[model samples]
Target chain A: MNWYRKLSIKQKQVVWAWTFLALPVLFYVVIRFYPTFGSVLLSFQDWNLLGSKTWIGLENYEKLVADPVFWKVFNNTFIYLLLGTPVSLLISFIIAYHLDKVSFLHATIRAMYFIPFMTSAVAMAWLWRWFYQPVPVGLFNNFLASIGISQLPFLKSTFSALPSVLAPAIWAGLGFQIIIFMAGLRAIPQSYYEAAQIDGVGPWTVLREITIPLLKPTLVFLVVFSSIGFLRIFDQVFNMTTNDPGGPLNSTKPLVLMIYDTAFNAFDMGYAAAQTVVLFTILLLVSLLQLYVMRERT
Target chain B: MKSWKKTIIGATAGAVMALSAGFAQAVEIEYWQYFYEARVTAIDTLIEKFEAENPDITVKHTTFPYADYRTKVAAAIPSGQGPDVVQLFYGWLNDYVEAKLITPLPTDAFPPAMIEKEFFPMVQAMKKDGAYMALPTAVRSLALFYNTRLFEEAGIDGPPKTLDELVEIAKKLTKKDAAGNITQVGITTGMNAQDHHWWREVLTRQFGGDPYKDDYKTVNYNDEAGAAALKWYSELETLHEVTQAGFMDEGQAAFKAGRAGMHIDGSFRIGALKSTRGLKWGVAELPAGPDGMKSNYSSYWVNGITSKATGEKKAAALKFLAFVTSDEAMQIWLDTVGELPAKPSAALTDANKADPVFGPFINGLGYAKTTIFANESGQRQVIMDAMQRILLEDQSPADAVAVAAEAEQKILNEYYK
Candidate 1:
């Protein structure tokens, strides 16, 4: 009691700040920190989820390097990020830009676009799978056939498979991204557009110079957010190719799916943990790289 | 004096009734299984019957969806908690035994000699180190399930018995639109993406070559027979042009719609085919490979007792197991589940043998072989990937098989180590 009374004002503020921070701090330690470090430790050990873990050190990493499937899946993960993010981002921005200017049935139209994002990913993946099927079966193929178009092997061919799987994923994400872009568009001052009009600058010019420059923060946030989502993509690939997940010679298999297969299907926990660590490193590097590249100049 | 004597007798009788009630509190043992409509109903029915038969032993049943069944069981069993009697796929039998998660049924309980004498040859897969760790009530084997109406439309008399005849029938049955688009396929060869089982388990055997040898440690499919089998499978799409990748939609779409002339699938699909209205289908033994050998893949999901079950709980679990594997239970399982009885005596009845639909699957089990997959799911995917190369990417069957063999060999080596 005497020591508590002896504390200065600065000391009291420090203690108060920590008192408020206690729960979240404890949560981070238990829920986040523990598993993370445990996984890292586990990457260096062999475990079958049923046996005692043995320290095998670097062997898991060595095997991963030699594993051909890992390389294929690594490329697939990047393809999801490289292709999915930009394509979805562009589509969302276009919709949002046009949508912001609209007055009639704006809410309804916005809701329509947002519905896909809110729908369950697994259901969306399966629905798109049906859409990608060939003639007399798929809606897309039937429509093509009715109009005298060759049936596209959307989900079957290795060349077209990733994009086919990616299409629904991009579509599913558009609603959320569009909503974000719309919010950002709405936040911009009307005065800038008015001034640009007075200057007789064209709409495209204003869009490139003012609207985009002002929306940098939102763009950065969304880019980082969607990039991570694409990087960790599993459900879409898993459900769409449920019959042959990551198939057509593993053209659609991603890092997360590979990690899952190694852990559960193969019961190679050590190898899976190694893949997880690689995924973590990739996520970290990609985010950092994006942040650095997109940094606002001083 | 007479009234006093009567009261004493009544009190003694009452005391005896109380003592009996105390002893009959019921020993409850829980059973866990994967959720399929038929499976759930069958288990519930068995529980009702078993409970009625053993009034003192109460059996509680719980189920999870198929996808999560193995993971749920694996996680729960290690904590000394979970069902006393659990259902496991044969692929997982080795792992469970190795981990000591399941107790091998006491030799005294089901003598080793009795096992060989009574059960089908496939039941040997249930054993580890000459001890029966788990036993299945029902077993399944792959068979060629064809749409009978489609065959009639194609002007085919009956199911083809050999690979050459199948190709001839496929060419005849196929239909095309004006633009060269395949509107209806003659045969949806189960050789695309996920349909690798037909190629690996059944065809590999019928082609007169084994998939693995030296205790599943080495890949033995690098020879002439394996390549020939794979080449024939690839040619179905590449050269034959009768069955395309899109024909099946990679999800049994073509078969269910009756657009496919022939489908090679397991007996497990019988319920679905039968339930689909406006569809007439029949099951036949898979067409023989070049060597003229008939082979099929047989896999079983067995009920295993956990090591944690002990004393009275162990006794109750054993009672449930015995009841479920009994001839009566096997008959009920056969009638309800559309799977063959595991016991040879129970399955080989004249009525069952002569039945048109179920006959092929039952008879195919004579030469059927269960997978020795250490990681069955993983190994299946590896082989499937190999099939995809030949079917989709135009890779040579020899190269594809070799690559797949190497990958599978690695998995096997890792497991044994």
Candidate 2:
């Protein structure tokens, strides 16, 4: 009360503004920061969800380095990220651009594209599993047969399984990226397009010069989020592959799946946590690297 | 002197009060089980009957789904919060017993002589250290489930009994289109293989190789017999060209849709098959291996009264266990669940023998064995993972077996030494 009385009107307003901001900061600390810190601590110990923990310094980290399975799963996860993210972004950006052009159908087409993101991952994975079934009677295989193409091993082949999983992952993820890009595109001042038109720019040149540059922030965000999603990929691979984790010779296994297997199946929680820390570091470094690259480009 | 007399009186009064309170309170026994909706209903009915009979004691029932039950039990027991009576898979017996987490019942409490006379020798031999840690309630085994409609279309008579005959039937049953793309599989393998340890165990046994030594101290499956077993398994996809890799679920669907002839699965699949209308099917034992060994690994759902239980509560739990293992309860279970009764007196009945769906199970039980539970979880995982790698990845059996043996030995040395 004394401080407020002593302060000028502007200083009082600044204090009120900070007080309002403090609430959200407190909320984040309680809900997010605390749990994140706790998980970091947990990563150093051997714990089952129900049991007492045993502390084992960096033994877990050491073991993770030697685990062949971890390398294979990590490779699969990177493959998923590499194959899924760009394809998704490209498709989404194109669709968003075209939908923006269509004045009347923009809303409906946007909604249609967003429907996959709205659908549950479990349900989508189940549907995709049925479609990827390996026999002639299977949905996709039947379609392939009608066109006289031999049935491809969509999930079972070690060479193709990661890409096969990526298809559904990309499909499920496209809607979000599309909506994000659409929002970003809508925010682009129409005056820029008009200026480009005055310069006699073609459609492709306008897209490359103006649209891509303007949407850089959104693209960077999508890349970061999608990279995180791909690195921790678990549910679809687990459900669709009958909990094989690494299906048909460690093809579809990802880092998260590896963590789950180590902790639950092998009862090596310390090692699992070590792997999780490695994943977190990788994610952090990648996100930072992306932000730096994007900022430099700008 | 007066103060001393007062102190002694106070102590006596306190002791008397405690005794009276103890007598007034009824003993409570905790029972844990894993049951689906129907089994839960049946068990609840049985509990009602048991409680009505035992008026002085109360039995608290806690249940979980099959998938979570094992982990729940493992966690609960060590925390001193485990139930006084528990149901478990027989495979978990050694692990629990080795930990001394379960109390072994006295041989006199069971009708031991009668059990010896009636039950299969293999069933009784599962016990260790001269004490039975668990009593089997229901049993299941692997069998060849064949689609009758597909067999008729292929002009085959019936299921084969030998490997050569199986191969011959498989070749005929396989349907390839003009372009040589496989339209239908003759057999399916590796479905549920990750969780279903029985399949690998049965195959290992049929190859005339025991995966674990009798003492449970060493693994013995790296020999020629083990390699032959694995090779034969791989040949289903690699050599015979009857089944394709990763076609297990598809083959099951096809079999259900009347497109495939044979699929190997456990007796638990009866309900799913029965639900598929207009599909003619039959069950037979898995084909014999080169050594004419027909032994297939089987598993049992078991029940046991805990050591923590005592007095009237113990009696009540025992009564319920006895009833579930009794002829009447076995009949209800068999009729409702289509599971083979573990008790000889119940399983050997005319009704069970006459039922086609359950008959193969009973026959298979004669040749059934179980993987040796050596009280080491790591060893089990290592061996099972190796088998999966071989079957799924087409790793040479020799290499797989060698790795598995080495891993098993390492685990044994670390944990059991």
Q: lDDT of each structure?
A: 0.85, 0.74
Query: Which lDDT tens digits does candidate 1 get at residues A182-295?
Result: 999989999999999999999889999999999998999899999999999999999998777787778999999999888877778888999999999999999999999899
Poorly placed runs, candidate 1 (over 4 Å): A1-13, A194-201, B1-24, B192-195
TM-score for chain B considered on its own, for each of the candidates? 0.91, 0.81
What digit string (tens of lDDT, one per residue) describes model 1 on residues B1-417?
Answer: 999899999999999999888666678898999998777878888999999998889988999988788788888888888999999988787777888989999888877789888888778867778789989998988888788998888779999899898888888878889998877777786544324667777677777788778766777987777887888877877788788765646436688887888877777777667778998988888898766878778888899999878989899999999989888888788777788889888888898889887899899888887767788777777777777777766678899888888888887888888
Specify the poorest-scoring 10-residue window by lDDT in model 1 chain B.
B189-198
DockQ of each: 0.49, 0.16
Docking class of 1: acceptable
Cand. 2: chain B TM-score: 0.81
Report the error of model 2 at residue A290, Å: 2.1
RMSD of each predicted structure? 4.6, 7.7
TM-score of every prediction relative to native: 0.93, 0.83
Clashing pairs in 1: none
Chain A of candidate 1 scores what in TM-score? 0.95
